[model samples]
Target: MINFTLDQWYGWINAFLWPFARLLAMFSVAPVFGESTAPSIPKVGLAAVIAMVVAPTLPPFPALATSSYEGLLVLAQQVFIGMALGFVIRICFSAVQTAGDFVGLQMGLSLATLYDPSTHSNTEVLARLFNILAMLVFLVFNGHLLMLDVLIRSFTALPIGHASLNPAAWMGLAELGGKIFSSGLLLALPLIAALLTLNISLGILNRAAPQLSAFSVGFPIMLISGVLLLTVVLPHTPSYLNEFYQEMLGHMARIADTFAAPRGGAN
Candidate 1:
């Protein structure tokens, strides 16, 4: 008969639980896994499954009781690490949404809003459309699988109980968030420039003929021209979104670098 002491049982239980906690924290907030529309129970189940698979192979886990003070601190650190990793990907996905927002505003479609289950709030229609497209592209690139690979590898790069996150790395995340405005502007640039020139021409025409209501006539023309310009630009958006995704993954690794241990694995 195999005899297991109380401490060994505790260690075994905790080994599975600790990494499970981190996985939950991550998937709960990370993109499609965390989308407001997704039910919570499935996310928990998925995390549990991954933990079971991953726990056995992990290096010896710290024997910290889930209820103790030290254990609480460790739990908090794991959550922090999870949020940091998930947020990096969220920032990347936001780039497309940001671009769509600019295009919508320029096209006078700002008033067209939809209830976005992903956010549980009203979002611009164009942003939502772009979000759908980005999702499709993400799947095409096998990003979901890549994310799972990264999660497993993170144990090696940022093993349990060895958490020590550097604060300086947050600056990098802030910079990532800031990319929304600049990149969005770049995405919408062709339309914005074209619209500006159109508006100028309309202004000159209005000056030449005061009787015609320039506002009424220019609105339809701008709308039509914006549609044309959007069609012209649509072909190029996939490449831009692809590049942004790559950048997001790079930054994700960099931000976590502050907290991750030096270990070799899929990340």
Candidate 2:
């Protein structure tokens, strides 16, 4: 039987360690897995399991060893790469949340914030509804599968030890952020215009009858009108969610391109 020396065994274990560490780092900070609501023990366990599965499929280990500072640098780079990918997806989801917040504020539902167990932050009621709907739609459309596919493809496109950020890619991510305002405004436009009309009408009524309590009269009417408008627009939400997922996948593809580009090449 073939025999391995102590140094050879150490080298073999080290070879797996770096790749495993990189994968763990990626999963640790990546959006869904990185959320604060996720238990630390489970997250660590899942990361280890994923690393075990993915490490063998990856390219050969880089020359860097865990014993050196360079290994730590590589670990950091891997984590950054994974986090950047997850962040892009997170930003896309935030567009819907932003739109919901704008709609809630315009509709006088600003005080209706609720604790979101997923994100562990208080979110507008409308935003929570939309976010939950978006997640459901994402699963319904197999977007989660697509996301996993992209992550797997990343291994080949941007192998281990090949982490580097592209400026153009970053600019693209910034542009994605800019879409939030546009999309949010678009989603809120109809409601905003209707509210403005109601406000103007109330103003006229107030001017005509000083004895009338505008606040008392206007609040219920506005609330009812907002509810009716939301009902009317509810049917369109699925279409918007579908579009958002499509855009998200496209952005992920762009990120892949950015990560896959040569060190000095354009994304």
Best by lDDT: 1
* lDDT tens readout by residue for model 1, 1-267: 999987787787778788888888878777778787789899899999999999989887787776788777877888877887888778766877887788788777889899998888899988898888888888788777777777677877777888456666665667678877777788778878888888899899999998988898988888899889878888777887778777777777666665652333213
| TM-score, per-candidate, Cα-based | 0.90, 0.83
Q: How many Å off is the CA of 26 in candidate 2?
A: 4.8
lDDT of 2 by residue, 1-267 (tens): 999876676457655665556555655554456566779888778667766777777777676556678767776766766766666667656777787888788678889999987777899998888677766777788876676667666777777666565667766767777777777677667777888798789989999999998989988888888889888987777787778777777787678678668666864
Report clash pairs, candidate 1.
157-261
Residue 160 lDDT in model 2?
Answer: 67
Show where candidate 1 strays beyond 4 Å: 1-3, 261-267
RMSD in Å for all candidates:
3.4, 3.0
Model 2 pairs in collision: none
| Per-residue error (Å), model 2, residue 30 | 4.7
Instruction: Point to the candidate with the largest TM-score.
Output: 1
